[model samples]
Target chain A: MDIGQTLYWIGLAGCAVFAISGALAAAEKQHDIMSFILLGVVTGIGGGTVRDLILDRPVFWLVDPLYLEVCIAAAGLTFFAARKIKFKHKALVWMDAAGMALFSIMAAQISQQWHASWMVAMVMAMITASFGGIIRDVLLDQMPVVLEPEIYVSASLLGALGYLLTCSFQGVEDGSANYLALAIGFSIAFSVRGAAIIWDLRLPKFPPPAAE
Target chain B: MDIGQTLYWIGLAGCAVFAISGALAAAEKQHDIMSFILLGVVTGIGGGTVRDLILDRPVFWLVDPLYLEVCIAAAGLTFFAARKIKFKHKALVWMDAAGMALFSIMAAQISQQWHASWMVAMVMAMITASFGGIIRDVLLDQMPVVLEPEIYVSASLLGALGYLLTCSFQGVEDGSANYLALAIGFSIAFSVRGAAIIWDLRLPKFPPPAAE
Candidate 1:
């Protein structure tokens, strides 16, 4: 199979995983079916929507309905199988990491197509990777994962840099380079995040100073 | 005062009003002080940020911190006065209408400066007037006002059209034309909204079809 097609399938898988994670989150909160479906759709397409809006392009899902269909199916499956699932939180984090890594590379690649500066491309990648979860958390009335002094944003940044570096080295001539870079990026982010979860590695927090 | 200076003052007052409304909303939710402050800042600057971001211009508040300071002061004042204030919701709607009217005109005027088409300019105006409150509602886990099938979007559209029509008639030289248009817009929106609230005039909802 061609590399681009392979990467497309992998990205779709990532979307499905994230949709399941979103459904699990909503189920944990005991939301209705409509809310669960809404959350799933939002989580699956939210990153790409923001990226396209910021870039002044039409939304990706509007151009192709596959992403939306995948999200719907994932939500439906999760709704029926919620009781069968175990280790929900662990699954969520891992799936989120995969989704973030995939989206980051996709954003950077799109920006590169637009011939944006490297810095702008990197920023777009980070926004695409993290802003969906941020919006989700904000809507859930919780502190965004990005603001939690976690390694989340840092991992996304690292993944984006890895993708950019790979693209720079091998050039865009070989389609396989894209897949290779994405794999490397996703592995880095997921491994670091998994280690963080296991070892409880966290960023330092500052306490409020004494009142005068 | 010159017409430009007068409009600027009115716009600043609108900003303050929206800031207060934002603080009141936060107070209702019983958020922490910092969260309240953040809400105020977002409500005050969110519209302009969305406008500038869509227009691909530098964000306005980042260029001038005065807007931020004004919002912060307004939030602090509202926090202290919230309990003592009577008819808070009424005040919020009136203040929001004023802000929406002013922002709609400002967005159109700015878009005209950019030499954008009238259609694009009008859309930008509507976005600038409504996006902040939409973001606020979305963050608060409520349905966005824009999606409520109400007169909110229509009000902003009409306000922008008013500004454009007045400018055309006055040759953009008559200083009073701006304020006249703004006043008309605000009055129309506020009166309609107030009547709706008082009389319980709601848009018709779609009835569900009978199950088979």
Candidate 2:
């Protein structure tokens, strides 16, 4: 496939992963089907939608109907199939990490295309990678995992930084640079996050402050 | 002030009101200053940002730095001054309603600029008026007030519909038509919401579904 096709499939894969993660999160809440679908769609599109809103760009789902349909479809699949799957938590964490890794690199590259500085690109990557999960957690009345010293946001940041560095240092053509950056960034995030899932890795949290 | 200046001040007023409401909401959580500020800023701009994102337009805060700055400043003011105010709950509801009224009309007008249909305009108005509170409630792990059978979203929808009707029925020029619509819309929202608050009005909730 060409560059455009490659990116398209990558983006859709990210959305699908997010969708499954959303359904999984909803399952924890004992919510009904509508809630599952809503959570699924929101988790699938929330990050990119927030990014587009911040950047004042057209929402991809609105312009292309397929993205929305696919998210709902993915959610429906999960709603019926989730109970049948063994090792649900393991599946969830790995899929969520994969989604975060893919979206982090893609977001970093897209931010670069928008001529954003490295700082902006990295921040966008974090947002694009973790915001969907944040939305799901919020809807479920749970603390966002990223805010809980989890490896999720840090993984995305590492990948985003990697992507930016590769682009600036490689002096390659745009197309090749993006592919290479994506490879490097995705690898960094995937490996680190995978290790985190396996080891239950987490950052340290500060003790609660004394009462005023 | 010309129309531009008029809208600018109105928008800032809406932001300030939202900022105060956000701070008030955070007070319920016993959160620290940073969390308050974050919640305040998110509440002030969250709705509009969501609207712009869904519509695929530039975020207003990014284009004008003042909006962000003002929201933060307003939040800080509330952080310091909230305790000193008497009748705080009354102040919150009144100020929030006022903000919703102005933002609903303004958002409806702005959505018209994008050539959205009346349906889209009203939906945008409701989003601009209520989404911030939704975000705030989500962050606080509380149910959104708009979902509590309150007249909030309904009020905004009513106002937006009134605005569109005025535009259609009146043969006045665009400028004058906009002003008149704003007046009509604001009046509808403000009076209804005010009465609701004073009378403790609420729509009946659906009876709970039987357990499966």
Candidate 3:
């Protein structure tokens, strides 16, 4: 596939995965159908919405109705399928990792197109890859997983830096370089997150000071 | 007092009121101190944050520490004082109306400064006046009050248009026009909301269509 098509498919898959994960999360809370749909739609589009707002563009889903339709379908599918599935927590973690990996690279690419600084690009990528879950948790009245000592934002940061470094490399053809960079970015994020889960790795904690 | 000082005090009072409203709302949910603080901060600054993000400026509260300090104090005091307060709901609605009015005028003034079209300015004003509460509701896992068949967005819309009309007539001489416009705008919103509450007024709803 061409670079553009590859990116499109990756994003679509990411959206679907995120929608499923969101539905599952809502199911854990025993929310009603409308609430589940709301979570699914927000999780599917949240990253891109934040990115577009920051970029001062009309939101991507608003521009394309298909994104909304897909989210709706995914929410319905997830709601029914969740009842039949076991080990849902494991599936949720991996699906979230996949979504984060895909969105981080996509956000970085869009930022580069806007000619923003690398720092800005990276920040956008992290926000795009992470804020959806944060919003989902906050809306569910739970503390966000981002605030937990996980490899969440850290993994996205690594992926974004990988994409940036790949863009800076010479002698690679344009089409080949884009795919390679995206693949590398996704792999980095996915691998880090998977390893963190398996190894139970965590970032250092900041203990609250004792009150007098 | 000069118009600027008047606006300053009004905005501060609005922030304090919104913060108390947020604290009360969270208290109803039985949220802990941290969540209460977070909700209060969001309710007080959320509208301006949406405005700045849309305008592509650094978030206003982040740029101005005074806003953050005020929100924190408002939440802290509200936490202690809520038990002693009667008619909390009445106070919240009134304060929210004042905040909405001030923000609508301020948003219009800012948009005019940017030299945007009047339509864009009005839209910005409405967004600035209503988005915080919308966001607070959404984050609290409730349907956005704006999307409900309520007078919320309509009130902001009317207030914004009132500010615009006043500006067109009186011009922005010595900022007097600004505060006067805001007062008129707030009065309009408050009156409309009060009428809606008293009369149980609701927007028209369409009946469900026949089955396909």
Candidate 4:
């Protein structure tokens, strides 16, 4: 398949992963089926929706709604599977990391397509990668994982910045090098986030003020 | 003043109020000034941003950015004032209710202007009216007020539906009836939400199913 087709499939997979993670999060609340679906769909689309809004682009899900269908299907499947399978916390984290990697790269690519500045592209990529999970946690009444002293947003940021740097350094004015850049960017994001999860990595906290 | 100018001023006032409410919410966390500004700006503009995205319109603040300035100014003021004043819980609630009322009417009117169906208008209105506070609560790691079995969203819904009903019944094709409708809509929303806050009104809980 061409690069466009590859990216399309990967984006859908990312949405599915995010949706499943959301359903898993909702499992903690033991909410009803509708709640699972709602949470799943919102988590899957919330980030990209916000990104598109900020960028003044057409909302991705609204343009086609196939993304919404994918999220709904994923949520429904997870809701049923959750009845039998005890979802592990690690499994959820891994899935979230994967989703974050894919979304971060894709969002960076889209931002580049829109001719956004490097800073805006990186910020958009981070938002697109992280905000979905944040929305899910909020809806579940849990502290968002991003707000913790974790490496989550940092990983996404590194990946997005890596993607932009790869494109620019390779002189991708004709856009021929974007496919390789996308892969490299995705890999960087996933590896950093994955390693952080396994090694329990965290960013350092601000030092308390010196005693008077 | 003309209705257009009146509405414009009210919208700015609403943004300021919402921004202050967000800053007040952040005071619970005692975060730095930057966090206060971020939270306040997000709460002030987030709902309308979502509505504009869904409606495929240019985002309101992007078109002018005056709203952003208002939010930032309000947040900065609140941050300083918080050091000197003990903010009351009741004050926040009342401010939130007023913001809800103003935003609900404005959103309903905008939906009508965009020629949305009654149901779509009501839903958009509720989303625009409530999502700001929901986002603020989420960022603060608090349970969203809308999800707490309260009459918040219902009040917005009622007001939006009331506005549309009044417009349609009165044959508002000429658009001259909109000012009266806006006033009525705002009054209904504020009265209902205010009453709920004063009396601790609540929606009924689901009854437990009978044993087989």
Candidate 1 C-alpha lDDT tens digits along B152-193: 777777777776776777676232436665666556655665
| iRMSD, per candidate, in listed order | 8.3, 6.1, 8.6, 5.3
Model 2: clashing residue pairs? A53-B53, A56-B57, A56-B58
Top candidate, metric DockQ? 2
Candidate 1 wrong stretches, greater than 4 Å:
A171-177, A206-212, B1-49, B52-106, B113-170, B173-212
What value does the lDDT take at residue B205 in candidate 1?
Answer: 53
| Model 3 bad stretches (over 4 Å) | A171-177, A207-212, B1-49, B53-212
Cα lDDT listed for each candidate: 0.71, 0.79, 0.74, 0.81
Which candidate order results from sorting by TM-score in descending order?
Answer: 2, 4, 1, 3
Models 1 onward score TM values of 0.58, 0.62, 0.57, 0.61
Give the higher-DockQ candidate: 1 or 2: 2
Give a tens-digit lDDT track for model 3, residues B176-211.
Answer: 446667777777777777777667687765553453
Q: Which of 2 and 3 is ahead in TM-score?
A: 2
In candidate 4, what are the lDDT values of residues A1-212, reduced to their tens digit?
A: 88778888998999999998898888778888899899999999988988887878888998979999999999999888976765557668888999999999888888777666666577668779878998998778777776555578778988988888889888773334378788889999999988888788765332212211
Q: Cα deviation in Å at residue B9, candidate 4?
A: 6.0
1 or 4: which has the higher TM-score?
4
Which docking class does model 1 fall in? incorrect
Residue A60, candidate 4: how far off, in angstroms? 6.2
lDDT of 2: 0.79
| Weakest lDDT window of 10 consecutive positions for candidate 2 chain A | A203-212
Q: Chain A alone, model 4, TM-score?
A: 0.93
Q: Give the TM-score of chain A in candidate 1.
A: 0.89
What does the i-RMS of model 4 come to?
Answer: 5.3
